[model samples]
Target chain A: MGKILQKPTGFYDKFVRKPGTYDQVTHYCPGCGHGRIHKLIAEAMQNLEIGDQTVFISPVGCSVFAYYYFDCGNIQSAHGRAPAVGTGVARSNPHAITISYQGDGDLGAIGTSEIIHAANRGERMTIIFVNNGIYGMTGGQMAPTTLPGQITSTTPYGRDAATTGLPMKMCEIISQLDAPVYVERTAVTDAKGIMKTKRAITKALKSQKEGYGFSFVEILSACPIGWKMSANDSIKRIEEEMIPYFPLKTFKDEIADRTPRPVVPVAPSQEDVLKALGHDQKEEILFKNDKKFIDDFTTQKVRIAGFGGQGVLMAGTTLGMLGMELGLDVTWLPSYGPEMRGGTANCHVVLSNKEVGSPVVESPNVLIAMNEPSLVEFEPSVTPGGLVIVNSSVVVGKCKRSDVTVLEIPMTEIADSCGLKAAANMASISAYLAFSKVIEKDQLVTLIKAKFKKKSLIEQNVAVIEAAYKYVSDHVRG
Target chain B: MTNDDKDIPRVEIIPEECKGCELCVTQCPKDCLYMSDKINQFGYNVACYTGESCTGCGICFYACPEPGTIKVFKK
Candidate 1:
């Protein structure tokens, strides 16, 4: 019998995603270690029969286009976020063999938090970290794994350990955590080293397949072009210079003694999720048939603007809640500045019979201006035939437009008389209900009673709403 | 020799896919691989088999970086 060893099934036959005319060869430079490591991982995936269930997360760097080669499910993550993304993939699909392929510049520098937390949480994934001592894709700048006294573009005069600190030993750092099942540091400088690296990668992937918690393998790779050396010279550097600082050995191996992690529980049902979120379907039914006055207001885009302390956002929320109670589609978006009390704040409320397209109300059909600055700022954006409700207690200017109907109500003065000046937002909502005849004033009062927690404040807010409704009916509506 | 050639261990190297890195040539234990004087479409000399001392150890297959460049058959 004859045995043929060829390209593994994990790699695509034709790299269709690779740009230019080349389809068979990779974009890696001659004798680049990334290609060797990739071949080893691909062979492992094929031999383990897990290629069909794998999800390879390609990181930013020279291997950013790794998705073009690996035939399994591929997701190109942001710079240094492959571990975090792999966590999501592994957790969501527990049967998936998730692999996070990263580089030194990505994992050692910006993605340190992501890798540390993922390993600490014992995520079921395999991380193949390629450490080339310098940034390969970004033109050979000094990296977190760069050795001391190494000359890079950024470190022109040999890296000074006093200023730049020392090269990070990632395998040592990751093995210190209690969660990871296996951690090894290997190289790809020679045939023996390559075989060792292949075995380490295979072990890491096999542990992941058996649900044996997190596994990480740091491969000391060579960057011939990035290091400005011949391919053979680069391999020599990895053997003589890199191996002395970053030694090659298995740092942690708990695969033989550790038990398989428990399977994740299934997600909750939709009804149970709704119940957990405090949604009551029976209350929605109570107001669904109360469409008697729903036809009075047709699709109103309301804008509420005032100082930050004036409860402008609270007014918009009340309007949105009222629309939802009426069984209409609604959306509310609030915009505010840094200062909590004095800065400007505004909110947009969309109430529609059909599904609302966008929540933003660029040209509002109704404007509730609680201060003079708010009136001056948002008055021009109101539709011509809309209604304007001005809080006459604070607004000094009169409504200059003649096309739209304007209501001048002393909302703060009315609330102050009722002993709670903060209840002006309640007065504003009641005035709109009374003037538009959209819903009964008692509907808003019931909502207020249900919303407010304090007994004394509930009574005071109800009094303000009743007084404002009467004031609008007796003076403004007349 | 012609009849025994069918059972002898051998390797096949694709010319276009080879990057002339000489990794397989240098790493082969039997010294059966060599870089040709001619170049392929990418203007780099490709590796070839000497076809005499063949052990079929498959070390060359692991040393080469590009996928589908080397295929080893053992008898």
Candidate 2:
């Protein structure tokens, strides 16, 4: 009797659960290459002693039961999302070895975009792609890797390149990308072929274990039952048919080894966080106590809408910044039209004493409409007792809703008079704050002073904002 | 009696683990291994040893797709 090699310690001795219970057996069909590939992967992980630290992400299609086999951390991802899931696991657990195992149907079709983006980012992970050239899970269907004359359930008349396009050469396509440290394609049909696959799996896993960036090992496997061929014939077909189109290759081996980046010595402090983000840099210099503070309000939903060049979003941001300074929760959500729009821009601002759920203000308590369309669109959604501040210069129509308090201020005209027409957003914000008393006048002036860093514009902008305060007080208060 | 402990290769096939793909049958240079009509518990016809001529080059051990299915002991 010869010595027996026990199953790789990385695998559970038995797959006991499900439709059947079997010890030391996989659910793969006869002549299917998944079993052989699994053996190679487990051997590599065991050799590297990374099973405990490895997280396997399995997508849809065959091999989705990866958690049932490899005795490691396993996550079942959506159809095309294994790579994305692997990225999250790798980034969060920097010491962990992440593996994304996928079938051709899952990766080549629905997951094409995700794989491309993940490879572009060079997430530290190993991707094992099993290409059997047909969709195995949902019955043999036309896959992106299905050959030209190959007939599947979908392509019953054989694949037409004109109608369905040619089979994607994924290994060659992925190798063209710059980030992957290693890109290879190996088969498992013959003894020599299986040996090649084993070596390729080992190297791919080693790349991840050494903290190398993305490495991919794609295996051209066979599906005898689906191909309607005998086990021997199926193995032969890979050598005769598949090898011609997808030549066994190592498209990349090792990149110019990158110098390991030095670890960060110290965590940045709270002060550093504020300084780097340019937030709260100028300390608690409050608005002057010249105006009354609104202590009664718990939450304020403000929507500012205007034309693209009107700086409408900045007006909402100033309020958002003020909410942060006041130790209140705030969110600023901007809505910019498409690049070709050359149209309108809007922002939704939510300021609250407690946690805010949705940043979108569906029915706002305040609507600052700077143009005719904005007033026409948002005037109906304002709360009955809420404020509707309109820039009378550009917005010609009046607010037909008499339930809300509508204040028509010639903000654009006033900014033009001040020779700072671009300062209309700041002027409008200052006027709204002056009337609402959410923040005092001096604090508003302090924020303007602290926010604008330009020498000439600081004074120029502050003058326009103060004029807004004076205009609101004389016209509305009188 | 002095030749009792000979340094010859002894090959073993875990009958239960063999998928009966016959990769070993094709790879064995000495033509000592063949597929038998007998089926193992996994329901596939298993590979059998001829017990006649095996140089034990370890080709079958390498060729068997299932890990640990074949082993060559030189003792």
Candidate 3:
């Protein structure tokens, strides 16, 4: 006698990925519809020969472990993001058939926008949406597809549409979109319904394999544990309660007439990507640093604080970029209030000879305080014998701590003399460089020229750097 | 169809994998499948097949949710 029916080759021979001793069985409860649906999909995959090229995107539900069963390229996406992730996979690998397997709570609730947009855009992917009435993995919470007046854990009383709105009909919504090639709503309550579901799944996958646009199959499934009923009763509930609200039918099927989507070109190369981002590969050597300045400062954790428009973040970025140009490991972390101009702002700049462990600078070795309030707030966190550069133009107070060296510079007046007030950040950078001797004075001017494209602005910034360097040498050192 | 016992169609249910949902037992038209009282390691009574009048219909194979639980052999 010949073997008529057996497990499909789409499933792993032994579910070694499944945890626990029962690798032979799924993690689903007894008589769960997920097992039936999974079997049908696997059978379809085996029959279609797309198992090797299929990318199964599992959602954040009980079926989150679908990767354990489906022996294909699997990606466990965040809740409701399967469609978005499926779009990426299908677009990136045009020959690969992507399956976004989602559940009611995932597709209908949190992932509504993702599903709608993915379908609307007509991404060449198949979305298998399992619409059980209640949330299964989360213990019978009210799902967007829950039947009206159906009692759930969240709805202690029966679900009242006046308050929580009616159950969402996703197939109806998807079929209304212009891009979908096939949209069907099937069930898995009986053998006939299961067969119909298999057919619908096969058709959906076929549409995707042929490069047809979006295809969706919403399968009305049963949740025995979530419904607080036996497997048999849950199947009956699907027939008697769920089918009336969600009628089983093909809402749209254009696969027979639709043409395959055009093949997407391969991704761009690294040099092309850099060029697209406005960077020339040849100019990369402009920032290359020789090791001559490495001994001046092996590492520096600098904190710059000021009002929003005072370019605190810009100053930190300048320092970080200088360190990066020197071939040192650097990180710039910005923290600012919600306002556009006047709110408090600060950024931490870390420059290290080795890989910087953490970007957060709790106790900075260098503090650039642009205003009096910033100096008062951040002076205490400076390490002993650290350097504090105060913007004496904006600050009227004196530094109380005698341990750390304080350099009070008129940054605003210096920037004004250089013909741009915003260039005060460049002045601060020049002062830091001059005092620390981390890099030569001309290096800061060259960096300014490389950073600013406008001739006038570059000239003014260079003037500010030179003037600030002169002030540091003549006033602070003298 | 042969009258020989070995030549007749039948189904074999893996006792360890059968979850005892009884969907197969209820859906079997030939009335050959039944739930046996022998509990397997996971502690549920598993479905069993009768030796006679087997038509080899694959309804029970599809009805049972657990994959590889039921394998049907046809005449």
Say which candidate scores most in lDDT: 1
TM-score for candidate 2, please give it.
0.80
**Which of the CAPRI classes, incorrect, acceptable, medium or high, describes model 1?**
medium
Q: Which runs in model 3 stand beyond 4 Å of their true positions? A: A1-3, A17-24, A284-289, A296-298, A338-344, B1-10, B51-57, B73-75
CAPRI docking class of candidate 3: medium
The best candidate by DockQ is 1
TM-score of each: 0.86, 0.80, 0.90
Q: Model 2, stretches more than 4 Å misplaced?
A: A1-3, A16-20, A48-55, A71-99, A113-126, A175-183, A203-215, A249-276, A279-295, A338-342, A416-419, A453-456, A460-462, B1-75
Query: What DockQ does each listed candidate score?
Result: 0.69, 0.27, 0.64
lDDT of 1 by residue, A1-478 (tens): 3888788888998898635768988989888899999999889989999989999999999999999899899999999999999989988898999999999999999899999999999999999999999999989999999999999999999899999999999999999999999999999978899999999999999998998989999999989999998777888999999999999999999999899877685477788988987774544332545554555558989999999999899999988987888788899999999999999999999998879999999999899999999999999999999999999999999999998989999999999999999988888878887898766777777777776557779999989988998899799766
Q: How much does each candidate deviate from the true structure in C-alpha RMSD?
A: 3.6, 4.9, 2.9
Per-residue lDDT of model 2, residues A25-108, tens digit only: 666676677777887788788999999999999889778887888889999999989999998897777788999999999899
Candidates' chain A TM-scores = 0.84, 0.83, 0.91
| Candidate 3's TM-score | 0.90
* Candidate 1 deviant stretches above 4 angstroms: A18-23, A158-165, A286-301, A305-311, A327-329, A336-346, A352-408, A416-422, A436-463, B1-3
Quick one: ranking by TM-score, best first? 3, 1, 2
| Candidate that beats the other on lDDT, 1 or 2, i.e. the better one | 1
* Local lDDT at B58 for model 1: 86
Better of 1 and 3 by lDDT: 1
